[model samples]
Target: MSKISVLIVTYNYGRFLAECIDSVMAQDCGEELEILVVDDGSTDDTPKVVANFPQVNYIRQEHRGVSAARNTALKRATGDYLAFLDADDYWKPEKLRLQMAYLKEHPECKIVFTAYENFLESSVSAQEEWVKRCCQFAEHDIACLPTALFHRSILNQCGLFSEDLERGEDSEWTYQIWLQKIPRAYMEEKLYLRRLHGKNLTGSGAKQCKEQRKQFQKDIVHKSIRAVRRNNMEKNGISVLIPAWNAQKFIVECIESVKKQKFTELPVEIIVVDDGSEDDTAELAKQAGAVVCKAEHRGAAASRNTAITMAQYSWLFFLDADDRLTEGAFEALYAPIQKDGSLSAVFSYARDFYDLPGRSTNAGEEGKVRTYSGCLPGCSLIRKEVFRKVGPFDLQLKTGETVAWQLKFRNTGLPSCRIEYVTLERRIHENNTGRRMRGQEQMDYARILREHLRQKKKGE
Candidate 1:
């Protein structure tokens, strides 16, 4: 048996998986270690991402929740000592080395865990300081799963995770073991890192926390959805298409926001087209419960063309990796298209959340930010058949490709609507490509409009 077997239960943590694995593998004290990753029916490119790591023992199963996934990993683990890590969290190099030493020294101690740090991902408020916060002495007196290392004998005594819960499985399992009166040790040094972002199970109130209440009045827009089974939703479906390239920083919040949309009556599926990101974009997108497709490093328009083929639903809505949809984004768009077969598409007003950026807290006051209305491609939801007529985006044009496609839609003279409800959010960061292409946007958009008018005259 190996000295320690690390059980990592992952649903869709593509972007963080490699770092988590590397953290354990770097344990220099050198006891034999086996790392097992259990992927619970991830629809993203997890299989491909895991293949990049040959050292890990990877097992995949159907779309069970994290509880079942943990139970699956527990059964396959072979080491005498066991440690559990969430895929989105990782350990410091000495984490395994220190915990193992503690377990070895205290024969009476059945479990040992170290203090940890929290790596907060996205912060909206400007006043919030994001320096890494480590779990201090006695901070986590009760053990967190990510920091805990236990003997295999403890498993024989307490049993595996309860497979019933969708959220608090780890807590429930640890609470059960805590009742057994098993001797456990806690180290003061921070040896693990928990990455907290808006997508976390407790996605409420991260924005309005005490960090900002002292400085400025807070406006929070928090909306979330439970990942219920698809069978429970309506037969009419809405598919979200996101084009990603080097979007590891923003994709999680983007996908999580989509999951929380207010259209509970319609089935929603997110499709992320990885536009040849050299970074962890594809893996991260998949881990965030998006279906991922790989494509060559083309421009944004071409990536959308690739996503068109992979979409499973009847209606398609395009989203940029850095942008997000609000809770009721689909409310105005879906029914109009469903009721009027002739309507080619329905578009919504977009709030450009510039001040707070992508991870905005107060949805109500977000309107104070700059908002854009009329024919924004990212805010529009289109019928799939409309694409067959408009054809794929112009390959020759590097920018303003969406404007060119919009021109084609105008050429068809089909019915469409502009709704007053704020359906989507356009995030403005330093890297926003549109911010750099202002002059080109005007020129290309004018050219496309002229071309459409010429086509209209020719048809008449």
Candidate 2:
């Protein structure tokens, strides 16, 4: 039989404590039940009342707020499933039966919630009328914490309730369930009772509480949309594009860095475009387990564009042949996009590293590293759709093709974010494209700026 832990958190509600405990004890479901009544330092006759129920486990703690109380109970719970009930409210006798049946039927659902009815404390006879009014306002359609039954393992994955927010802690916790896309189901039956009274937490300031609740709901919905978008975009995993031109010396290390990400489960494919290298760059890349695509004597811009055409995923990461990704680089750059889907790309800082004077290239690799904060392409995790929106890199620019691409991306008014942490280690040495073609890069920068100005003027 499945075991269920029922948590009842109460604060200064001695009169209603018996009724709440009785309702839980009245559960007809033939499953092992562990009922815990956590008294949040109530001065009332809460202890005396709880003592009357010999089967219930009573624990008291200093009043640290509701979220803290809930977290405390969570730590002590030992069951396969968890269910919560408010001290001021009670559940229907069939609530657990129906919810457990639903879980049994739908094995994929990790959590389930039921509809609830709200009634006033003073007028017990006015419940039917109140239910009707709540229906008209669609207030009885929600699934709150009291009506929720979820697997205990969810806490291990999603984490405990936030203690910082004064209100909307339940909403905040529920938002995480939605963001993670956990399989959930909702029953239509109103199986939970919400006792509305003067002392109700949401009744302190009627107008302000309503506005705050609305704002909280709005934020949850907005965040859920962004999370769903991120999940969809992540379905195909990431395509790491590396454009190499005579970079045989550093190609293996670059490819190895991509392969050894902290999140090794993330589906990643490395595509190295050998841009007409005279050395064994293509052979080395293929030996390093990257899918090598040989191309004519095109610049990095053309090679990148060619790689884009060959890419099979929705997300893209550009890695220069001579650069290396830092520890946990993928997780750091991908987190911002997961939080906010409106971002076109996420960038991390890169550190420029160079060999010491008279150091042998073939010897043990030692270099001096310095922080470089520019939003370079090598440190960016971009969505494939961004390429469609901003178009391909400019083939005309020899050294600053990425500069022109960055300008075009900015012109589209799409948002992007940067993580201050360094995710890329860029090697600064001879044959560095930007260092070798300084004069051409300067002219390209000026041309890119002029083009941007012309476009801005035309739009105005």
Candidate 3:
């Protein structure tokens, strides 16, 4: 048996398969290495390309999914270590050599993954920091499949990949391996290059890709639900807390959105804290069947604290009265908590819909907006225990109050994860709170910045 088996699963990728195969062949390792290429019934010249590489052991199978092709390759692989490389991705010549040396040094690690740079056409750039922001990673997390190298023994223990999952199969497999107490090591080197082109599966259809990502997240949630059921853990209920001031125009829509969540198995309580709205906000929330907690003309910070104090569930989700939750938002928020009991909070993306000029563009691809650092208030779910330890939102501040609390939570060193799957639609109109209290907002923001600077100076 060879010491390393390089598995490449391809389907109609004739354009880039040769470069991938050549990278493996160029590895300078002295140990014997075998290349296993599984073709998923490609009608293109992919077979001819593989045939030209005389040393590559190639097999043609029916058009199964990537997971099936990878499993087929695993069955034929006869090596102590197995590494997956996509046909469109290639690794550096020293990738295998350096990873093998690291594995040799750390015998306890069952899986090892390295950082990778992304390429568009011929120009290479680091992977988007927003991607890392959405998903929490160690300093050296594997950015792509080509950077990952794992011992064959991990496969034996964690089982094969889920053939049903067309997207996020690798993430599911890795999460399962971690659940089995298999230690993983990260190499801080960019050892691979992942090509980004229109022909790639994820890049082909933007809407379809987004839907598939949501489906992948649903699978993750389902896995967590199963774990919670089997272990009989403390199945925490979720409190949908909405802090409203003068949101009479949109409070009903917000309450209705929460009531329409996909995951209704867990008990959900809607707590609407009204901060002395002169409008009909309190009446709207009460008529919509929410528990309305009336406060005497306080700001959003005070209203949020009031809702938290009245919350009965251990898990709390703050939803603005003018915002609406996407379908399955609660399920996606609670999934990580069910899977990993150690997590303190889970956040998702919040999209702003404003009629104002220059605000119409979607900020998703524009990288992390400095305006909303930490977690977006309207789209986050947090464990009640975290608030118990870190305390409540800063009622002293008139604006950016939620962000102030998020920063405090971050300072507490806890496991936090963000998924881009769930989204909250934030409606921005003329009567928005920020618009009404612009001066107060600026003042509060300046105060927060000054406090941050003071803290940094003290630490130094």
> lDDT scores for all predictions?
0.70, 0.78, 0.74
Output the worst ten-in-a-row residue range by lDDT, candidate 2.
134-143
Instruction: Please rank every candidate by TM-score, starting with the best.
Output: 3, 2, 1
- In candidate 2, the residue pairs with backbone N, CA or C atoms under 3 Å apart (3 or more residues apart, or in different chains) clash, namely none
> What value does the lDDT take at residue 130 in candidate 3?
36
Encode model 3's per-residue lDDT on 373-425: one tens digit a residue.
Answer: 22666578888657646777787898888877776777778899988674676
- TM-scores, all candidates, are 0.46, 0.48, 0.50
lDDT of 1 by residue, 157-224 (tens): 77987665444455445544544546555554678887765555222433333333322112110100
Model 2: per-residue Cα lDDT over 1-460, one tens digit each: 9999999999999999899988999898788999999999999999999999998889899998889999988999998999999998898999898888868865767888776777767733345654354333225212476789999978877799888767677877876775564666555467898886656423343444555566565765456546656775234578899999999999999999888887753688888888889999999998999877666676889788867755656688888999888778889887887789688788778777764366423212334545665447677888876775677888888877776787677778888887987888777777787778889888988998899899889889
Highest lDDT: which candidate?
2
- lDDT of the structure predicted as candidate 1: 0.70
The TM-score of candidate 3 is 0.50
